[model samples]
Target: MSEGKKMTSSRRLQLKSLMLQIATKRLEEEKKEVAAAKEAYIIENCPPPDLSGDMAALTEFCKKLHIAIDKIDEGRYDIEAKVQKINKEVRDKQQANCFKL
Candidate 1:
């Protein structure tokens, strides 16, 4: 009986170790996937600046880029606000329906 118990314990330990290894591997894979996605996003949305230009040209380029970024940020904020308002309305309706039920 004692030998059987030892075997069971050993098997459980082995299974637990295997599960941990698998979970660690999955976490590593997810990290890699996230990193690849981040790299792709940066490549697509954040173009590298042209460093071959004169100081004046570079300054002008930076000024234009900053203005464009500000505009994009404003648009994003507006859209986010709208989405939040819509979500709140939906939630309120859901709660009202739940109370009626």
Candidate 2:
């Protein structure tokens, strides 16, 4: 892996950790935006169930809620996968260096 200038495992792990944190924060922001959009869309289209008592409006709200929930879930899964992959690399690098010593 080190043909030229070599990076220590500790340095590689630090860089990967920083990258993971940035990615996680970005995903969190996106999730917040999606939640806000969901709220706005629902309020604009649907009203309180007791006040509106409209089936169509309630269904619209439900659909929008599900859409937002799905997006959030997908984002969480993506972030988790990225974390796992990075963690695996860090673990592997640590193990490789440990065995070398």
Candidate 3:
């Protein structure tokens, strides 16, 4: 009947509106979470510099920062090399198994 169709359409619109509101809330929460994560990353990895120091003190601080960066880079390189070695070994073993089969 015409009345039934109208009721169904009204319910559909209400559901759509509710879903849109929920989605908007979820999007806002995700944005806040992302912003928090970025702030934490900056706080952990990008410390604020001591700008009130003399030139010599500033130079020393820079040198220390550079050394820390170099150490992190070396550690990353070592891990990458280990991963490559393991991958190569796995491939070699797989090929050997295929040949045996």
lDDT by candidate, in order shown = 0.95, 0.93, 0.95
Q: Deviation in angstroms for 50 in model 2?
A: 9.0
TM-score of 3: 0.63
Residues 15-95, candidate 2, lDDT per residue (tens digit)? 999999999999999999999999999999977655364888888878888999999999999999999999999999999
Q: Which pairs in model 2 have colliding backbones?
A: none
- Give one digit per residue, the lDDT tens place, for model 1 in 1-101: 35443567889999999999999999999999999999999999999888799999989998998999999999999999999999999999999999999
Which 10 successive residues of model 1 have the least lDDT summed? 1-10
In every candidate, how many clashes are there?
Answer: 0, 0, 0
Runs with alpha carbons beyond 4 Å of true place in candidate 1: 1-9
Better of 2 and 3 by lDDT: 3
Each prediction's TM-score versus the true structure: 0.72, 0.49, 0.63
RMSD of each: 4.5, 14.7, 6.0
Candidate 2: residue 63 lDDT (0-100): 85
Q: Which runs in model 3 stand beyond 4 Å of their true positions?
A: 1-32, 44-46
